[model samples]
Target: MNTTPASSPPAPVAALVQMTSGIDPDANLAAIDRAMGEAAAGGASMAFLPEMSLLLDRDRARSAPHIAREADSPWPAALQALAQKHGLWLHSGSIPLLADDGERRVNRSHVIAADGSIRARYDKIHMFDVTLPSGENWTESSAYAGGEALTVVETPLGKMGLSVCYDLRFPELYRAMVDRGATLIAIPAAFTVSTGEAHWHVLMRARAIETGCHIVAAAQSGTHADGRETYGHSVAVDPWGIVLADAGCGAAAGDGGYRLSFAPVASAAVDRARQAIPLARSRANRRITL
Candidate 1:
């Protein structure tokens, strides 16, 4: 079922959905449903959404009860149905789900097949537990547990790597995925306004250039119900560090609300980038004898 880029089609298009989810799940799903339809209609074979697509409530105590379980959660089933309806691969950026202890939660990512089945799942590894320079305190570890394993899965777009918001800060994870033959990496993020403005584009470009893989990032933009603001520049970058598509500004800036940006995730670009850079292979051949 797994195939390399050489064996796949030439231009495999992907859609990145930029959203501003509130505390309400039903309303958010409605928005996503509409975006999925638009992506499919636009001829995208796959769609990627941002982290916390379901809910973003500031009160941890109030948000605890809303966490869903994959085994029984309607969100997965709903997403599966959406993928099946659109006949497209769907990558959910991240969701807060009940963890092993049933008390703690995990930031989980999902890859849905065209037939409405979950193909792969990845829990977020990094926890955003720092106090920002703006005096905004966040302790994600207090509410969510870190995932243990790296996730790379076969898709129509070639080998795909999965990660969440805070995980983007770590380059080693992307390098590891590249070593595993990943040609595309998806990072679903709910990056804060302060940090996103400072480091979002640079980090994304760096990852793509270093790995020679396309970076598809869907982001949460604008202010949310929790009074927290997000820098909303959901972008798609090619392997050569070029931004193929961007959401520009928020929905208020004349961009359609919950709009999906379509971009070409071509295998030829990956092939050319790897051939030109060869960094992945170069690292493997490096020798250091002690």
Candidate 2:
């Protein structure tokens, strides 16, 4: 009987891309191509992109044509080509696609292998339907349906959990992912300037610390053609909650501009963090009495 456990994969370098996407899908694809090329040249095994990586148009009337079914849309094929061209795996942040019902869209993420094949897909489970203190209202649920299942996939970097913007507020989702053996989690977002400045860093570090998993967040930055502003600061954090890299905000992430940052994803770091605290063991032993 073979009882030996599978060994963890070696660490791989990941590239985080912070972009300021507008309403144009073609331009966004070009930006991604440029970034992927740079990531490959810089020795990144995989590249992570921000949410709404393709089209960020909030105007339903204008974005309707672009938010077609995944099978029908050309964007996925285009992205596959880019991955194959760069010979790198790609974590497509999130794209809006028409749901099966055809009445609403779903915010979905794709994990593409180096061979240009899609290994996994995750739809954003949480909806951002808040009216910020700045009076900026966002009703994501109006246009998008929440996803039903959690997604964790194996990559050269490690077992990765996928989540999109607004999902960060839900801790249970991340805990569930950790229970499923995710050593790293991706939280690609298009955060508003106001809430982002308040909770982005704090929440990101908290997730990493609580799960003992590395957190890689690619973000959208600067003002967009739709008259909305996003918080930049694309960041990568280790399992110990240390920020490995952060692409800062403001002019450095101006509209139509993009920034790339790199971080090392190692199983050793996950091992050290989990072994130091052993939170999982403690949680399993505890009994919650209401």
Candidate 3:
């Protein structure tokens, strides 16, 4: 009865759902609901949603079920329902999950099965604490607690790694993830228009090339009412760092991150026909310190 191989890889062809969110979680949920319906109707086998899929607020822990939305929160129920309804696996790239410490919140990413079961949870380890040149500043460490461990889950898509918006800036984190057997990565971000235009695609491509993994990055593009301008170039990159699909601004003004930021996690359907380029090979021009 045990005829299956222990090391068979998963299928390729992942779907990256990009969106634009605001302060209202309910409206955000409604948008994603409609988006998911459309994506499913379009024959997308899986979907990946971006960070703050349910809520984007300066207020602390408002999106967490226990904090603001509670059980009545539409995010969990809707995500579960959407997955079950479409018979697709969904990756909630990040959410305002209740933190281990009651005082703070966790920027957590959840992996949900088609049956509405939660397979894994990854709290963002690195926070986006930066003061941009344009006088815009974000202090994520103030209201949120950082995670200590990394998360990699086994799925129909193979080993799945978790990451959030600011995490994209840290390649060592991704390097660590890929070394731990992550063949596919999901990046859900609300990146600033400045950084997004300058480094977003380059960073995504670099991560994929270094890890030999396929990446599906869904971004928040456009200017938000919060006076924040986000870069909105959602991209899907292959293992060799080829950007296959780029959600460019058609007629949208400016490279704001709020053009659209809702996204989903699809199954890891990668073209493994390409050679397994391990990160070890990237140790190019290493000195013989031994």
Q: By lDDT, is 1 or 3 better? A: 1
Off by over 4 Å in 2: 1-10, 250-256
**Candidate 2: tens digits of C-alpha lDDT, residues 44-141:** 99999999999888899999978898988998899999999999999999988999888899999999999999999999999999988999999999
TM-score of every candidate relative to the true structure: 0.93, 0.94, 0.81
C-alpha lDDT of candidate 1 relative to the true structure: 0.88
Q: Rank by TM-score, descending?
A: 2, 1, 3
Q: Please report the candidate that would top lDDT against the real structure.
A: 2
Estimate candidate 1's RMSD in Å. Answer: 4.5
Error in Å for residue 226 of model 3: 3.0
> Which lDDT tens digits does candidate 1 get at residues 1-290?
76755656459899999998888888888888889988999999899999989887878888866776667577888888889988999998888888867877899999998998788999999999999998989999988899999999998888999999888889999989987889999999999988988999999999999989999999998888888888989999999999999886565444334867999988899989989988857777889743
By lDDT, the better pick of 1 and 2 is: 2
Query: Least lDDT summed over 10 consecutive residues: which range in candidate 1?
Result: 248-257
Give candidate 1's error at residue 194 in angstroms.
0.7
TM-score of 1: 0.93
